[model samples]
Target: MSHAAALTLPFDTDTILEGLKSWAACESPTFDAAAVNRMMDIAGRELALLGANIDRIPGRLGLGDCVRARFPHPSGETTAGILILAHLDTVHPIGTLEKLPIRVEGPLCYGPGICDMKGGTYIAVEAIRQLLRAKVATPLPITVLLTCDEEIGSPSTRDLIEAEAARARYVLVPEPARPDGGVVTGRYAIARFNLRATGKPSHAGSRLGEGRSAIREICRQTLAIEEMTTEDCTFSVGVIHGGQWVNCVATHCDAEALSMAKRQEDLDAGVAKMLGLRATGNDVSLEVKRGVTRPVWEPDAGVMALYDKARYIANAIGFDIAHQSSGGGSDGNFTGAMGVPTLDGLGVSGAKMHTLEEHIEIASLVPRARLIAGLLTTLGA
Candidate 1:
């Protein structure tokens, strides 16, 4: 239920903050492949400087690249390396960096993608810096994976992530645990959906009785589906467009949305129920495409061990931190779901992800950097 405190080495807070600044200079937007590539170039250069052997792997659905780096023990033994996964692309756009640059005001660094992963990337990068500078070789080697499309559910880089994860003894995701600096032991699974309802269209005025209103039927299904949603799993109509003419009965109805589940069974139940519902007396058609890209990373015993390790380290460093589960999904979802001992929320904290309001707790920079350094030390031993 508890763990021993961890050990730490000396590192400069200023230098680490500078490292964060260097990362913020690039506008790594996941939606823009060009921007993603540019961010990859930046990550590659810094990782190379930190003594990692870097490579560029092509993406699945974008022009961006999955940049991977490895630092093997001098002995070249297969037994000694841990994989560090981070993403090069932030959720912010190209113009975001300009309008909202990294600024340390009070205890927060307000900027784009500051806490999501950019801040975490710097923590990982700096951990490498300290290790290299100290010439502290671990019993385990280290591999760093920086992807260009993490925000987009990592659709383009999941394969590479899984491949790298397969070889490592430990996996760390700097997803910015929480403002309190607690770690994430488990996160909800993600399921995206595209639902459509169809019906014949006719004049709304005279022939209303003869025509089947797709929009009306869709509204009914939407309400029915809305009631189907529960707190454990959620569904929504993010985008909906139906009807060609205002006076005419709508012929077609369509909607696209994202759904999430805290548990696998609940997710399945939600999806199954949504699909099973048939058209009502109006003779409407129903079609649902169920898509689950991210599996739920349950907080199983193995995952709990990693969080325990982090908690132990925090305690050792005079910080009593607790690990909690979240509704969000991270790269840890895949690795942990695959049965790897994984830990996430190791990045900076500032809240407001996927929005321009995203930022980092400036005060958390050095502490999180030290936290990561301490975590790596534990992994090495």
Candidate 2:
């Protein structure tokens, strides 16, 4: 039997589900520092139970703390090893569990933040736990880093991620698996822009002609901004806020937009176009400011080599996993772009991410855990 096949027997589906539900129950939204920390605390306790040396880095920029757990090696090899990257935060608010409670129905399990990432994060921890229980000694030591701000583009944790990855031989991110049970080897470049429209305010009773309504200007600009979408680059305005009262012409409006491209040059050109936007109406001003961005991660020979090993392991475990260049952004983008051999989307297989209906296939938990355990044992050996 293959090494992965041997590891599969130790991961019980029921045990994995119970542990995963605890993570999903915490509801650590990205903006809620305390909630995110609570999730971190749970993770930290689990790692401590495994006898791993843990380091808790205090959060910055109003974000939650990050946890780094280093597993001791039998041979005491302190050189570069595997880095398992994960995030505990989700997009769902604090009380999402009331609507989407954690429960198993047939082969599918449902909960808030269950599919998007909590499932994957918990599985990684479980993989380590099983490995320790089985007394398996890997060729290299392992480190797991769980951050708190990936959903919001990882503003505070990007530097920490890169630093960890720079010293590691390989990086694995357990973001939600691809819809077809595939893995991610590359990701599209993404950019965010903040937009503002300013115009003169006037009363609606009589001087309507004298006022240039910022709300109207912003509406016109939103259409134009969305019209910039094309095959190479896509743009969308996701958030807009304006006008306070019906009686007076609004003097200010604000909006936010997101752009994605397969190439860095294409994303840069799109950024330039967005920043070059000019107001069509006289005396009105429009401004576009760039926000957080994720660079494109093109698969290299090293990346493909890592994927090949994962594919081989999956096949041995009685399943197959394909690879693709995904659209959504993750911390993998940072490490992959830095030329680190990174494999992402190795989490639970599921659908309806970032929605109330998010869930994972109960059948996927054991096989996926086996896949991760196989890599931890065989890679670099």
Candidate 3:
């Protein structure tokens, strides 16, 4: 049967829109624990209406609950099923959502985090609703885990996510479909690191010879790091703040990095380059803290087996789905690295994430929701 035909809830557009509007009203900034919790509150209320039992999981750093809502089949079977993963945290701050609410600009639903994840969250809930209404009892039980810290690295919830994925036969991430509507089979493993350079303080003008400017040491190293970044690898000095005053020789300087690529060699080489950057001609104490986090998500035979199943699910939906790899990272990176059958970009087709122009397509909702619902209903059954 077609997804539209299989759907029992009639694809309630009003319901979805209302849910999105109500959700967008709340600011769910991952940077702010309170904000994320508020967004989770909105999610809980909406999920409750569908007869799902929602509970608050303890968060290490946030006020919002890492919700684990259960909707068991009447048969009471909880053996196994597809684990739907969608992060509730967004990169935007509290005011972005309300100040930048989702608007129908043409056929798009524009809002902060709408593309990167809020839309995926929408599809996750909507798909479950469709599946429940159709009375499709998954062969395995279904568990929907919405973590509040995905934007900042799973941190507290990553262990929980891995435990869940390890038990389930399949995992699906609704991180927003690609512009061409391609699903992601592989993602670059992400590693975030910070670097700081310290030096002697002396007058920049009078005692310039006595001063070992940490600022100068950092600047030279920045150039070396820039040289390390290549086409295949992406490394950025995303944050930089330092120095005491203009006249005095600045004693401190620092920079933060967000790094990624397909190969470990690339990441390691990049790290070595940063860590090996000694005090350039200056008398400075240069320090590089090794903070390599997150493993890579390469497509392996086992994950490929699961992709076959996903492709089959797509075929059943009157479409032939294709897979792609990405340099961006997600919790899916953690799971996928574990060799789970992880599929990403399973949400609505939208782009411009982490920016004010982010959006999800109104038209893509039904199709993507159908695809997600189908994956949930068919996998591991």
lDDT of each: 0.76, 0.91, 0.76
Q: What are the per-residue Cα lDDT tens digits for candidate 1 across 132-251? A: 776665656778888877776777778888888888788889887675778888888887666777888778898988788877776877777777677788876666889888889887
**Residue-wise C-alpha lDDT for candidate 3, range 52-101, written one tens digit per residue:** 78888877854456887777555453555567888988888867755667
Best by lDDT: 2
- Candidate 3: which pairs clash? 37-64, 80-140
Off by over 4 Å in 2: 1-8, 75-77, 204-210
The alpha-carbon lDDT assigned to residue 197 of candidate 1 equals: 79
Residue range 288-352, candidate 2, lDDT tens digits: 89998999999999999999999998998889999999898999999999999999999999988
- Candidates in order: C-alpha RMSD to true structure: 3.9, 1.9, 2.8
Top TM-score hit? 2
lDDT of 3: 0.76
Candidate 2 least-lDDT 10 residues: 1-10
